[model samples]
Target: MGLVTIAGMAESGDIPMREPLAYFLTWTTYGTWLPGDQRGWVEKPGRFREPNRNMEVANREQMTEPEFVLTSPQRALVELTIRDHCKFRQWSMHAVNCRTNHVHVVVTATGYSPDDVMKQFKSWCTRRLKEHASKPEAPARGPTKNPANSLPLTLRQKFWTRGGSKRIIFDQEGMENAITYTLDGQ
Candidate 1:
């Protein structure tokens, strides 16, 4: 693959959100574990030849039932939400993929920290999801609670972890890697 030169750079604190930012995000439902090996909702082979253990074969629902992994619909929703929210927030998206276990976003943050950008994105998406899910005639399933809800009222936590893993793309090689990693499954 060749160099993926975005409109701007994915810099650290000094960088802005409007330029270029590549953020790969993975937020779960409460304490729900993702597609790896937490709940075993989607059975896998004990060994390499134990059975068909193709990761691509698994669906998002199977991944999110026990966790809040991105479903196909959710992925589409995320893409649309990203476009709409970015336009509203004046951000730019280089590339975005809603994986089975997490969300990979390659964007441009012209004037915001990765953390702030992610927070804004997550908050906006969450609100949009909540609003889209609410209806007068139908019962709102809404967001699900993790098993951790057994804790006290003050202990009850919200969805998504506190922070995310962000990196700065210094050169074309790194940028290509970031883009490929964001697109192709690991």
Candidate 2:
């Protein structure tokens, strides 16, 4: 059924007329933030799972390499990747900030889930990071982050955590908040 808005409702017959105004996506680099983080953690469906110290320890034990922290070049590459991809896809990017441990993005992309958006960002970023890592002149700017980890950046298995925070913003206010948070809150 086609959605009509005359009744001050956004759906009709359980079908939405359009997607949310924007998507607020946040994700961390691999191994940096464990499952049982003291700041809280999301399991699925945006619900917070109970914190468990044992779970955190178990997560740490499963690591094959040190946590991935974005170097200055890496961070810049990531943001550029996102911008390029978004431009190619004709998606609207409200804001994007890539930090050492995590990254935040606010965007409006039709016909795609927030999960897909995050995956695209992570995948492209990984590809770019690998390419950058292989360059002999690529400066290892953040050399102190994981100095003891034996694996070279180029050979690392993954660059990001499996899943991330994806919030659907339904209104203009929420979209503004997301953009502000992505641009300035980090």
lDDT of 1 at 145: 36
Candidate 2 local lDDT, 1-186, one digit each (tens): 333222222221233455677777889998888888767687764357877889899998998777887777778999999999999999999999999889998888998977789899999998888887787787752243455434677778877899887776667877777777778776
**Runs with alpha carbons beyond 4 Å of true place in candidate 2:** 1-17, 141-150
- The 10 consecutive residues of candidate 2 with the worst lDDT sum are 4-13
- For each predicted model, how many residue pairs clash, with residues at least 3 apart or on different chains? 14, 0
Model 1 off-target regions past 4 Å? 1-29, 34-70, 136-157
Cα deviation at 58, candidate 1, in Å, is: 28
Index of the highest-lDDT prediction: 2
lDDT (CA) per prediction: 0.50, 0.76
Please give each candidate's TM-score. Answer: 0.57, 0.84
